[model samples]
Each structure stands twice: as C-alpha cells, then as structure tokens.
Target: MSQVFIVTDSTADIPDELVAKYQIHVVPLRVVFDQETYLDGIELSPATFYEKLGKAKVLPTTSQPSPVEFMNVYSQILNDHPGSQIVSIHLSSGMSGTYQSALLGKSMLEDEQTAEITVIDSKSASYGYGLLALHAAQLAQAGKNAEEIEAAVLKLHEQRKLYFLVDTLEYLQKGGRIGKASAVLGTLLNIKPVLSIDNEGIIYAVEKIRGQKKAMERIIQMFEQDFAGQRINIAVGHTANPASAETFISLIETRFELGEVVYPNIGAVIGSHVGFGTIAIFVWPA
Candidate 1:
C-alpha cells in the first residue's frame, strides 16, 4: 500500500473502475424513495435508480451520511492500512453537509487517526470533485506525502470548471433550487437550461435555449472558450443517457485535444436532484 490514501463521498460520481484501480474509499449518502432508503451506489445502482425514477409517482430525496458513518469509514481505512495517512475529499458544503460531517468524524478520531486525516470540501460536484480526488490518489500512489497531495488537490479544485445541461427545469424548481417561478413555466414550454455551480456551489442557470441542440452547441462554445489551445482533462456524466453523452464527447474532441475523458454515471445522490436526461461535463488542465 502507498503511504497515503484517498477517500471521497458518493456525490463525486466517480467511475467504479477508477475507484477500484486507485483503491479510493467512498462513503455513500442515503437515497430515500418515500418509505424506502438505500445507500447511494451501495444498495442502489445508478441504472436501477434511474429506471425507477422514470416510473415513480414521487421524486426521491437524498440525505448526507451521518458523522458516525464517516467516522466508521475513517476507522476502517486506518485499520486496513496501518501507517497510511488519509485525505478525505467530499462534496461541497454549500450543496450538502457531508464535508462538515467528515470534519466532525475526523475530529472524533483517536489520537493516532487525528494527525493523519484531513477532510476537504471539494467546492464542486459530480466528476468535477471526482477528478480532484483522483489527482490526490495519483499523487499518493506516486509516494507523495499527504501535505503535497492536499496542496495539489486544492489547486485543481480552484481551477476545475463544471457545467450541466438539464432537459427540463422541473427538478430544480420542484427541489426549490430554482428561485424563479418563471423558469419552471419556461421548462414546460420546452426551454433547456445550461447550469453551472457558483463559487458557493449553488447551481445557477447560465443560459436558456429553446432546443436541445442549441443548448449543447452553446455548451461546446463555452468549452472552447476555457480549453482552447490546450489539452484538458474532461469528464462527462449523465443521469441515464449514454448515447447523448457519447455524441457530445465526440463533438468536444473535434473542438479540443483532450488528455483523457472519463465517463461515469451520475450517482443516485446527484440523480435524485438533477432528474433524468441531464448531461454534465467537467473540464480542467490535464
């Protein structure tokens, strides 16, 4: 094992393959469908969650894991990897309290677990945060110390760009995330919304277009503005539409040279809020 380890919450939407390859520990959030609840990505798979979402009468809700859950995960990591240090990356505190929970968990740790564990609010969501955790894992695997890995992760978190294109605004409206009632009516009238998270990690509508193609094209144009003349690390995530994601990625490749493009299904936690037919893309320096 490496001298350092990485941990993140389910909100990161990291691909299983990469998580397995890096041995990144993931603590799951809870997804509740009325009376039923399941751990995000544990008892609930993305495919099953999306399928149920399409047919459910009511939308599911999500809750962050408790401090006990995080503490247990921290303890398990220390138990499994005896002298290793930990960097616990998590979803933005603005979106959820998972980061604060991690911090509390770390504080409650035994003396041995105290000095080695560091909790970070990624200040981004989906694979935007996933890539940050991945970068830390890479550094850890290369034998970098915890402090060095953390410094690199924070720098990347600041530079990461994330934008999502939703098929409708109903989810945002119903979830009370969209403040304007007009936006909800606009969605019913067939307006696609391009959204991005602010520095505070709250989602905001960047553009509203009449058609899906125009919205996607506009997103591509925005990508060119940020990543033009340089290679970038790109990650594309979807609620359930892989075909749309693949086609969008093809268009992106034609516009800019990419180092590697990771495709991960949007997890149950994010899916519950974004609804179906949402395609989000994240970009950063390679």
Candidate 2:
C-alpha cells in the first residue's frame, strides 16, 4: 500500500502534539516586528507574540512563505518517503497567498514528483481548515490515498461551520482583514463582532452583539440551529484566552454528541489579525 502524508502552513494553528503524532509537515509564515522577523510558531511562540502585541505601539506584519520554501519542504518529505503521495492543504487563498505559493511549489517539482502531490485551497482559516488538515492526516494514517482523503476533507469543508468572537475590531481593522464588516467598525464600540469566512474564503461579520458573553452564546445558538441532533467533532481555538475556550467547549459538549475535541491555539500570524481574547469555534459532523 502507498503511504500518504499531510502538509499545511503554520496558519492552520494545529496543536504541536497532534502535528508530531501525525507527522504533519507545517511550513511557517513570516511574522515581522519592524526589522525583526520570526517564523510564526517556530522562533516565536504564541504566548510571546501576545505579550509583545500587548505592549507594541505598532502592529506587527505577516508574510506568506515563498514558493521556494514550500518546494523545499515538499522535496524533503518526498526524499524521506520516496514515492509517497503528499496532500498539501493550506490557509484560504482569499485570506493569504500561501495556497497559491504551494501551487507554484508543486509546479516547480519534477513532473513525476508533481504527479504524486495534490495542492488544496482550504477556503477556511485558523483551526477551521486546521481541523480539515488534521482529519486528512488521520485518513492518511488509516491507509487512505490522497484522492480519498482530499474528497473527505472537501466534503467536511462544505459542511463545517466556524464562528469567532473578537475582543475588539482594532486588530482586524489595522490588519486590513475585516473584509465586509469594515463598514461598521467605527460605530461598533462595545459591540462584539461575530466573524466567519464566507464560501469564497473571505471574512465577514455574521452578527454583532452588545456583550462578549452574548456573542459567544450566539455562536452556539447558530451551531445548534445548523447541526441539531448530529454527532460532531469540535475544535475550540483561542488567542491567549483559555477561559473563554473552556466555556465554549462546555457549552458545545452539552449541546451535541462529540467525537473529538481539540484545543488549538491561534498562532502569531493569525493572532496578529484577530488580537488577544479572541475565541473561535469550528464544528462539523463526525
């Protein structure tokens, strides 16, 4: 039987132990603070990034990995596991150019090497598509081929629902990722914005509520409406906010039958855009 491997970017925000257990290959994106640069989850940890973010006068910037970087990781993977099939999943192309760079890297490979590789645009971000990559890796480990795994992932991508509540819209506004919700920014002073990625992978406001606690409940309500009576897997993601994440997990566990529960920390790159105290909940049928 042929072996299949999973590849994703640091923006996926998948937990380290799961990444290690699945042997998932993650290419790091660049996180820049003035002239200083650090790999997203590598040189800089999420806790450190949040600490710096709290004090920094200016917001940090992020950059996608180069095609050469992707090519190198892919080459290394194939080198170690000769003739293995690779499924490279990535952050939404609408949010970042990481997916396109992955495609270019695939193009740079030898025809034979390229043939065994599949590049996918997750059209989701944070642990939204992060869960997809994890599921794909699980399928790959179960002896599923790249085709079967990709199909399974894409199917879940369509069915999955993700919602995030930001402490403040300031980071998203400054980062220029506010998308459709940019209009209501100035007016939304104490109002928490509920955000989600649309089908095309763009961020948009799902709703705005008066309080943070209410907004979090609203997300669970939305999930209840969407996945009622279904067995599901849940991924709770947070940026320096575990209390809120645990609250979310507790609420979800009571509402649905869950298979797997994962706590994924929102890393530096995505954290830069969402800011601290942001909690994201991603759910799909098990």
Minimal lDDT window, size 10, model 1: 177-186
lDDT of 1 by residue, 155-182 (tens): 8878778888877677776666554323
lDDT of each: 0.85, 0.90
Model 2 scores worst on lDDT over the 10 consecutive residues at 181-190
Q: List the residue pairs that clash in candidate 2.
A: none
Candidate 1 local lDDT, residue 122:
82
**Candidate 2 error regions (>4 Å):** 186-189
- The TM-score values for the models, in the order shown, are 0.94, 0.97
Report the CA-based lDDT of candidate 1 relative to the real structure. Answer: 0.85
Q: Write the per-residue lDDT of candidate 2 for residues 25-101, one digit (tens) a residue.
A: 99999999977999999999999999998888889999999999999988888888897999999998988999999
TM-score quality measure for candidate 1: 0.94
